[model samples]
Target: MDQAVCCYRHPDRETGIRCTRCDKPICPECMVNASVGFHCRDCVNQRGGTHVQPRTIAGGSVTSDPFLITKILIGLNVLVFVLELALGDRIVDDFGLYAKCVDLQTLQPARCGVSDGEWYRVLTSAFIHERPSPVHIGFNMLSLWWIGAPLEQRLGRSRYIALYFVSALGASAAVLVIAPGALTIGASGAIFGLFGATAVYMRRMRYDMRPVIALLVLNIIFSFTWANVSWQGHLGGLLTGTVLAIGMLYAPRERRNLVQWGTCAAVLLVTLAVSAIAVSQVTS
Candidate 1:
């Protein structure tokens, strides 16, 4: 009588099955179903194995709906605009970005501004726009869809959201430094950040730069030329986004996530520091 072949894993247990990939005798417990045949744990856990999940360019998870985050952002901006219109100027007064502002009508004390401990205005102000100008929100939303959608798709949701938030805060900080006490509203700054990032990403991929360059130039000119526009916000957001995109896109593959997210944290901290200093200048 011939002796039975023992499983490589369980030497005591006799088995007829073998790992299709490595051709080693395996027990039933060690078998993993594959398209062609069974695979062992070692084969499945290898670098090019089925267990490995796909990753985005910036080390984000490859999502089924790449544009979901961009859509959500647009929805939030629209919702805030509607609330501003329905609830009156109180929304603007409370959320609008300013180093120092007062109730122009009442003239008693400005309920809004960074000086009075309303630091949240740094980010909230990006969502509110001029109530009388329907064009304000309209232009911003269109630009957002154009620039934000593709950027969000490439960078993925978490990285994209971080960029938007930090850019908005950076815009408020610049407003504090450049035009302190000036009331700034609209999503122009955040949208400008998207423009800057898109331009950088195009350059990284060696795409034609003429279109984004032209658009950025035209917008920059308009920001300075147009009355009631916050040029300071635009400038700040552009600088921040450009720097962040470089960090996210060029990170080393081995430590990509750590480097990319760390860059975001560093930029955010610097913006907060600048904002704090600006606030101190006003208060002191």
Candidate 2:
């Protein structure tokens, strides 16, 4: 009589199942289903590692679907909008980015702008919109959905998110430097960043750049022509996103990872330095 084969993982458990790749005996608990047959945990993990795609600049797994991050951003923006509507104009007053030099005490309604240490407006302002105008939130969210998906795919989740906040900060910094006393709200800066990044990537890949360039030109013109638009915010975001894209898409192959990350870090640091200077100028 032939002796029974025991599982490699659990010597006490005997089974007919064997790893598809290694042909080793395995118990049910150790088995991972494969296209042809079951593979053992070791074999399955090894195969997965072998088939793993290269990491992005930010060391995140590359995915074909960009919808996850894009949807999250959209959802957050919408959620904030709903809260703003529910809570009234108070939410906008507290969250909207304003010039540090603006004296909140002088405002008619009282506490309409940031107080002396409420610096979080730089980030919070991006999620809020002008309460009276649904069009502000509508257009920004529409642009976000339109441009964010492809950019997320190209940059990967981590890098895409990083680029977004960097662009936002750039916008806020511009507001602080150029028009610190004016109240600004909306994600237009980040949306413009997506547009800029997409254009840069497309240009680097030798794709036709006319469409993106035209869109950017039209938007800039609109910013100048439109009553409430912040041309400074748009310009700042576009410039920042373009610089980051150049680094991400055109780095040398031999040291691509290092160069990509280094470029992003450098841009972030410069933006921070600029913001710090602007804040100091405002406070002084």
Candidate 3:
């Protein structure tokens, strides 16, 4: 069967897999699978010859696409943060962007129609914060890059990304429970999950996690003292990440990939649900 290879750039073109760089249709002669994906000769040259595949991709089964997913995620987080800052006070004036955090008894933000809802806040709150401070974004981006790259390489792309979203939700759940109407934002929750994962990995390998643990603890403690930091978000991410790492590392290796993935996913969802419910109870 002569299967048509689709052009990477042109969705309409029917051809074999084209070069990533030059957009040329490459037959077996010209196509070379790079570290990330298949590329044509011209494309390869543009990238400075052969692509440098990471140790994880060369040896690990995790998809390359997911491994690079963190970059996009981090970028999105930053963009949203920027928008929140630019909008500033006008957020209430122009856009309806309002804090969902509300007092259980009175619901201040909700009274002004500012607080959207608990569920919507669960997702949107992570992207909104007080001013787009470099410190806020910098800490988050740094944490994600440090934790996400290695974890993505180790766990593969899908699981790594799944962990990120799940942990963020979990962090949100935590914030919702502790502070019903407390305005929150940033990727600290997800970063905490990464910290959790690192802690678990270090423990599993019987390596000294003292340094990482100390760093995590110190950060967490500081979050309590630091008026601006979302301590609940940090705690939520850390707990979710720890649980997920345990599931990822301890589950039977012989189990199907789907089962293993599901296990980790289930943990994250369950954790989020529990946190949300707990928060509702506490606040109520």
Candidate 4:
């Protein structure tokens, strides 16, 4: 076997230094010693040509910015939990702190607080949780992180964020129809959407579905076991995620943008319509 070439900057030179860039064998002439290893001129030029490096995880798949958006969401959840904790006994009686939507009497949008005009609670309630317990927030945030990060990395920031919010709204829309008087909070709906997305993504990508399918089953089982969990929200999120993922990943490649958007819009409208009918009877 030929001996490994030395990586020093000399043509005839031989030593056991490795090239940091490209990992090609570099006899001394080509070696430019850097902190990690000797690099060749071509490697340096290539690195320079690509001004911005793509971020990658250890296995080399591209990853999104880990700290900025994902961590910001986590931080907000934690901060809200802390604030809820600090309020102590006052938190229990205050309706303003928690998110509520819909008037019990009119079945229309109403203030979450005692007033009758705060319709924003329909969206705002997503950010809040029912209990102030650290464990509740911890579990929800952890679930979001676990499911959200991989998705953001794969789908890019904006699309992934849209997936989250839309799926959540779908879940809330379902909950509004199914259980209006029940105060629902936490990121579970969004988390369920991720599961739905993951399943569709894996199927579209031709990845193994065993792991993802198992997770879906376990979560559904857990929802049944746990008293406070919203089965409606979870089910709604899962269906929404499946439908959205189909639109995003498997919609006809030949279709124009407007056509695709219109298809998704029509599906979403039907979903909301069904949810509204469900909520009307249940919340009443």
Candidate 5:
């Protein structure tokens, strides 16, 4: 008079609960709570047995928290700025980018940079800003919030962060080549990188390009005209970001991740190679 059914996913487990959509029995492990009743993971994913995950424009996972990385980045910059104030200018002395290891007493290059293993400065210095002025950190954080959040949403966290550091390294490479002896610091390079990427994205999405263009032009002028600005870093980052964005956004969908990450890796290698040559050129 009565019949028994076993879970479809796990044959050994006996369950009375059936998925309302599929009417197939499911064990608790395979069950996802639904509004009406429990649903099999398959039913919930809505792709039959295999779940189809949502993907971002650049092939990263669609995430609930799109701006998480951007927020963390801004928090970090602000935290580091606070550290700069508390720790004094010594923080800058130790971390700021200059191609070579510099003797603190005379502030002259003591050895070949990056090649000799003090390579961390290339990326680290992007986080270090002038201690006295709030203007520098304020403007940069605002730019990061406004520009970075949207780009992060489009590219997703992994690609966005990769683009960021690559841009930083590109900026660092230019500093090493053009002004090796000078201590360069700030997020301007990375910000310019975001600006470049944003422009590419707008063009890709068929959005009006005039606003971003005008902003970029204004910033470029400011970098050159403003005293103590690192125009070299800005230009380097812009070029690198634009190139990287093209590779990411225009990659063939079938092999998107491979081509996208491969492009990032290639750009990174080229920047490092340039930095290596620059170290020798600047030191020699």
Candidate 6:
């Protein structure tokens, strides 16, 4: 047999393992585990790419299947819509978000009794939409598909999900504060949150932001101009997503994961606090 090859980085050491991809000798220090076998540092990095590959929470290269999470989210929305259609007003009455501050004294007790103090409505409402209005669900899901894949890839799975729910809560809180007597439903708040996050993240990455900015402006205008649109929900989710993105994108590299989680928690707590105050005001 020919003389054993030594690691490229460590000439003094001989290794039996060769990189699975490049077939180069790699010492323990230079070896990176792959699905098939060990790989050299160079080969691993090459496969992962030098630029444009997003990093995960643990700082490893993000190589998960693209748009996996986005697909699941869309699937969930569609499933819920189908269930709502079959169940009719029963689903809407139980799941749709109603203003906690609705004057029950003036309304029929049976109608208003279940509306107040239903905290779960804040989250469940996001999954339900007004029946017979395919336009509402259609536009929201389309926007989600447009932005969710890229944002999920950049932020990784955990952070992306966290940003979504927090932003949804923020929207619910806004509805309580700004329009506590109005019935609200739909994922527009979470979708708006994704939009805001994408806009901020793209700006930080030095990517062209005009398209995002224009979309945001047009959406804001549409929220205000369109009858029955909840501008408060849109604004609340947008602000929350933007703030969370700022924390995630600008955090110190030394402690990035900690800062990102902490920022999300802080935003969630503040939103809950605001919601609590609003509920108290309504009940009082």
Highest TM-score model number: 1
Instruction: State every prediction's TM-score relative to the real structure.
Output: 0.80, 0.76, 0.67, 0.65, 0.80, 0.78
**Which residue pairs clash within candidate 2?**
99-180
Off by over 4 Å in 6: 1-61, 101-116
Candidate 2 TM-score, C-alpha based: 0.76
Task: Report the C-alpha lDDT of model 1 over 143-250, residue by residue, as the tens digit.
Answer: 899899878877878999988888888788898888887888878888888888888887765555788899999999998999888899999999888878888878
> Rank order by lDDT, top first?
5, 1, 6, 2, 3, 4
Instruction: For model 5, give the 10-residue run with minimal summed lDDT.
Output: 47-56
lDDT of 4 by residue, 1-284 (tens): 54435444464544443467677655433444354444666776776643333321111123335435667778876776666677763443342212344655998755443123343444455566755556777788888888877766655455566667777777777776666666766678877988898788767645557899998999999987898888878887888777776676565434533443564576567765665565445434
lDDT of each: 0.81, 0.76, 0.63, 0.62, 0.84, 0.78
Model 2: per-residue lDDT, tens digit, 134-205?
888888888998899767865678778888988888888787778877788889987888888988876654
The numbered model that scores best in lDDT is 5
lDDT (tens digit, per residue) of candidate 3 on 200-249 = 76665454567997898899889899987778888987888788777776
Query: Candidate 5, clashing residue pairs?
Result: none
lDDT of 6 by residue, 41-108 (tens): 68667766433333432233455475788889888888889988898877777888775433357764
Clashing pairs in 6: none
Question: How many clashes in each candidate?
Answer: 1, 1, 6, 8, 0, 0
